[model samples]
Target: MAASSTTLTLRERWTRFVDEEMSTFVFSTGVYAAAICAKEYKELQPTPQRMQQALRKTGAKMPLITLSCAIGIAGMKMCILGVSRLREDYTRSSVLVACPVAGALLRAHRGPRAMAIGALSFGALGYGSDYLFSMWHRRNADAEEVRYALSLREHHNVHHNDAFFIETLQSNAYLLEASQK
Candidate 1:
């Protein structure tokens, strides 16, 4: 969800776009496929005729599932991307905006109430996910910074007499202390 940067080559952008879209679509398809399998197993017998009918039903549904998943996932991602770009940063608000659009698309056929419920549910999920992810990233970054600082301190200790190394270590320590505050 990083903002698209000017440094990204056209090829890199295209690759990222394809990778994100395809992965989401594949995941959606897999979930739907599993749901279909469960439904078939629960409702039908194992007889050859029943199995054949199930197979036909599966075959007919697969294409629609694939197409709908691909389109739906792509639409959601595109909306998120657009919102992120417009906001000039990847934030929970961007996801908050995008999820309602996706929810409306998903539940529009059900009626306004369904759409509103879907939008509220999806928006809450998206916002919570974004918040949790950001928290995780922040924690990881802090740990990494601490690790780097420790490594630098170890190096400085080994080169105890090196003024520049000692000075650099002290500066890093000061920065770390400031950050913790």
Candidate 2:
């Protein structure tokens, strides 16, 4: 029995590692491919370059854009992590509270145009991803076979603050504080 349990754990960990690696690879590849395609299509405005020239210029921008996107995403995630640590029982709604503050700071450093674009993209990316994850989990939870198995799944520690998803981040400013009961 002990040997079987140990083998199960090893298999679970290997599955997780493979899944993570595949997802990372797919995401990076898709982002780079999209960026390259967009740039080539944009440059086609100038008398439609030969296929060779377009292909040559295409890959050059992809790497840079991919790196920039990775950095931006990492920075945003870091900020979200920081905010959750600062507040108790942080939720997705709580993160929205920091959007305006971020916008203001960005506006001051950049400009209104940048702030507007950044705010829209940030809001969409953050909330959309959260919603998608929730939907995936909900689907799993609703499955007859998964319900029983879920209990055996490992859960991450919630020592600092328990983060949850809410439909909107624009909930009342005092909501977190008032929800202690």
Candidate 3:
């Protein structure tokens, strides 16, 4: 009876930890989405030149962003490991949680019913965990690297311009063909 109680206590603690971590992950993803939206909004504003200049200076913020990404990745890895262990130890409950969570993490888009359920479930479980983990890792390792990454993102955005895309496509084709053996 004592052993059983200890086991139950351990399981409860694990569940609580998972729940908290998952919540943090979700929050981080929401932040990332918000950041992306803000970038888009800045691009659309009348004073986009200032925004563009700021983006060009993003190299200064690289460390923060990189650390965050690293943390997010680590968190996701931990979540996967925890879920796998839980599934092996407690098949039914783990299935109930892990299946949907795994599906969502993978962004699986199968049939309508499965997709809808998986998306909603995974959205809830996987949340922004990955993003947060990665971001945290990047921030800790190289604060300045984030600025460069942001600049890269900005450059990529400009690549979406029709003229730029056309030019890039032509150039890429030439390079690819030229490099062929």
TM-score of each: 0.51, 0.40, 0.28
Best by lDDT: 1
Candidate 3 per-residue C-alpha lDDT over 1-181 given as tens digits, one digit per residue, 9 for 90 to 100: 4666446587787797677666765665556545644554455456777566555555444445444544544545556568768555643344334434544433332345754675576655544665566566655444334444445546777644757555655665554444432
List clashing residue pairs in candidate 1.
none
lDDT of 2 at 132: 82
Task: Give the local distance difference test score of model 3.
Answer: 0.53
Better by lDDT, candidate 3 or 1 = 1
Which regions of candidate 2 deviate over 4 angstroms? 1-29, 42-51, 94-116, 124-181
| Candidate 2 residue pairs that clash | none
Residue-pair clashes per candidate: 0, 0, 36
C-alpha local distance difference test of each model: 0.71, 0.53, 0.53
Which candidate, 1 or 3, would have the higher TM-score against the true structure? Answer: 1
lDDT of 1 by residue, 1-181 (tens): 6645677877887898787676776787788777776567534565776667766777777876676566556667788889888888997677678887776555554578977887788788888888888777766676576678667768666664567656765776665566555
Ranking by lDDT: 1, 2, 3
The true-structure Cα RMSD of candidate 1 reads: 8.8
On residues 1-181, what C-alpha lDDT tens digit does candidate 2 reach at each position? Answer: 4666446587786687566554654575576566566656644455455455656776765565555444444444456667888876678765764554443333333467776776776677667877888876655544533333233232543334323212112232233323322
